[model samples]
Target: MDAQAAAPEQNEVPTGAKQQQAQRPAEDLVWIDTPGIGQRGGIIIKDLRLSIKNGEFVYLIGKTGSGKSTLLRLLYGDVPLTAGVGRVAGFDLRRLDEESIPYLRRRLGIVFQDFQLLSDRNVYQNLAFVLRATGWRDETKIKERILEVLRNVGMQGTQDKFTYELSGGEQQRIAVARALLNEPELIIADEPTGNLDPNTSAEILRLLLDINHRQGTAVVMATHDYTMILKFPSRTVKIDGGTLHEVQKKTAEPSDRAKE
Candidate 1:
């Protein structure tokens, strides 16, 4: 990654970035509450009703097969359940119908560590494709949206650069921008900074925190970076021994904080 980061691209400041910086407070409801799952299984979330506030940062910590990703996936209706209910941005999981999945996805943003950028197209085209798929057709509007999202992710100049030519951080930033194109209410990031080094990882996490603080986009990051848990120290929600509770009980409001 360092080899690629030898030069930082000239990034342009976006007008919409400010709008994205402001976030509205969130209301509380049964976000992802699982009374339990299956008569005999390994996916029981157990009364795990959770709320990821309108603008919050939550770290989901747990070992492999601990259902961390499953819980995050549940928010966007990605995981089909054997039993249990979850809701996000007003969509219910128990009654999660196929018709409503698209609606639910529009309000949520998801980021993956692998930087799933299109290998063939340049940065601009990758983002352009997403905008078109989501219903934006105006050429002017599409370019504006693409530039806006790229600016928000701090990679405005890489619009013509191929993904393979970019550094790991840059590639990940593009993924983040793609996730932001829809301006989702909540962002679910799984191992977002996993492959980067300590310094690069910190920079990426700070960028995420900035997104959380500036735009009020509630973020749920499932990672093994307990060191980051100590470094940035946002509210934590650990799936230990199979249970969910506040990390410190500081913000019992339910909408804002969950951890420990």
Candidate 2:
């Protein structure tokens, strides 16, 4: 991304680019500025300020209870932003209501750590459900979209199989395909690789990176696998002490194991 080389230590905009970035709302897919975030009158995050530009892939890393999930929830409008400015794909987060949440999500693709595929539904039915919920009507168009996303995730021709009949990796691939069904501008992935084995985790990471590059979709993935971060370096942020910090990139030594 344009800001990778000059990432800030904190959540502030990179130096020398504030004037440039301040003027480009159209270029930023996610924009947030908030004093705090929480539920039930408790603050989990404080002084949060973050921006993710179009097509950028960013890793969100932090320990449990460090507010990583809370941050992602805020981005998707699951948690209301009680104060400050917050926007995602042109929707005002602070102003999001029950009626608008679905609309906001239609423009986003969300992947969960558990895969979240319905066990009772076949792959095609799972995908078709999302398309229909998002206002797709024609059966022909829905079928085409389902096949297209399945192909993108390298999981074609399994549309007839139940999700429970698939392996973990295959199931996750279907989940990724579901996230793509809407052609969303941004993908919010929360611990997408957490449940996979090492090799499968790498596969999922590579797939997300591929989509970020190929489709120009901004991705903000929260993960605990520092190993994956080492193997596939990218712009990353760490949530700590109720705030966010940019992690300096580290060069990884060549490893045959990582290659596999």
Candidate 3:
């Protein structure tokens, strides 16, 4: 599907306290309060409050089926907010509709545990396809953007390669590159390294950190890799029993991990 296609727009008013909270500055890429979200009439998470500031890197951790994925979906507008005040990438979550989804998405980039590249197309073709679908008419600009993103992810010369031909690590890098094509304000990564080896996972982590540092792109990454958390400590948030809580970092531990 074309990630940039326009959707319908709507606005919803939060009640009482939530309405007051929603009136605050929307500087953060994502802001929510006691939000209830789910799919198909089932509430996966409730009373979840969270905020992610610009250029911040937050690790979302939890056991399997603890609502990590559902929360990520909520941020990207895949799952509708059942109740509460929420805003993401300048769009009010409560007000989100089909017409505003694409605009909301354009301000953010999403990465998945599974690489969602087009198997039949070469790397360049895959990216070009997205750009074309999004209304890019200038061939020169499209090629430049593809090459720029590829360079950012260290996949500069692999544009001619097909998706099936690249290793898992390489494919993930391409995926990251694809996510960067629009220079999104926030990057929502859901277990982006889940399928890669340890070393490759570390490489992906380093790449993401580098992007966060250099481009000032805020990142909210849902992960199960506690080892990565220990290796590259940052602000950690845990989801349990359908609620979100900030995990305090251990003090008095000295290591080489970078600080946010």
lDDT (tens digit, per residue) of candidate 2 on 158-251: 9999987898999999999998877778999999988899999999988988887778888899999999887788778999988888895442
TM-score against truth, every candidate:
0.82, 0.86, 0.87
TM-score of 3: 0.87
Query: Compared with the true structure, what per-residue lDDT tens digits does model 3 show for residues 31-110?
Result: 89855778899877777889888888889999999989989999888988868888886677887777667666767788
Give the lDDT of residue 133 in candidate 3: 58
TM-score of 1: 0.82
**Local error of candidate 3 at residue 195 (angstroms):** 0.5
Off by over 4 Å in 3: 1-26, 249-260
Which residue pairs come into collision in candidate 3? 7-98, 7-99, 8-98, 8-99
- Give me the runs in candidate 2 sitting further than 4 Å from their true place: 1-24, 249-260
Off by over 4 Å in 1: 1-26, 37-44, 81-84, 251-260
lDDT of the structure predicted as candidate 1: 0.71
Which whole-number lDDT from 0 to 100 does residue 236 have in model 1?
83
Over the stretch 127-235, how does candidate 1's per-residue lDDT look in tens digits? 8887666656567767777787788878978899998899998888898998887777788899998999887787778778878777778888998988876767777
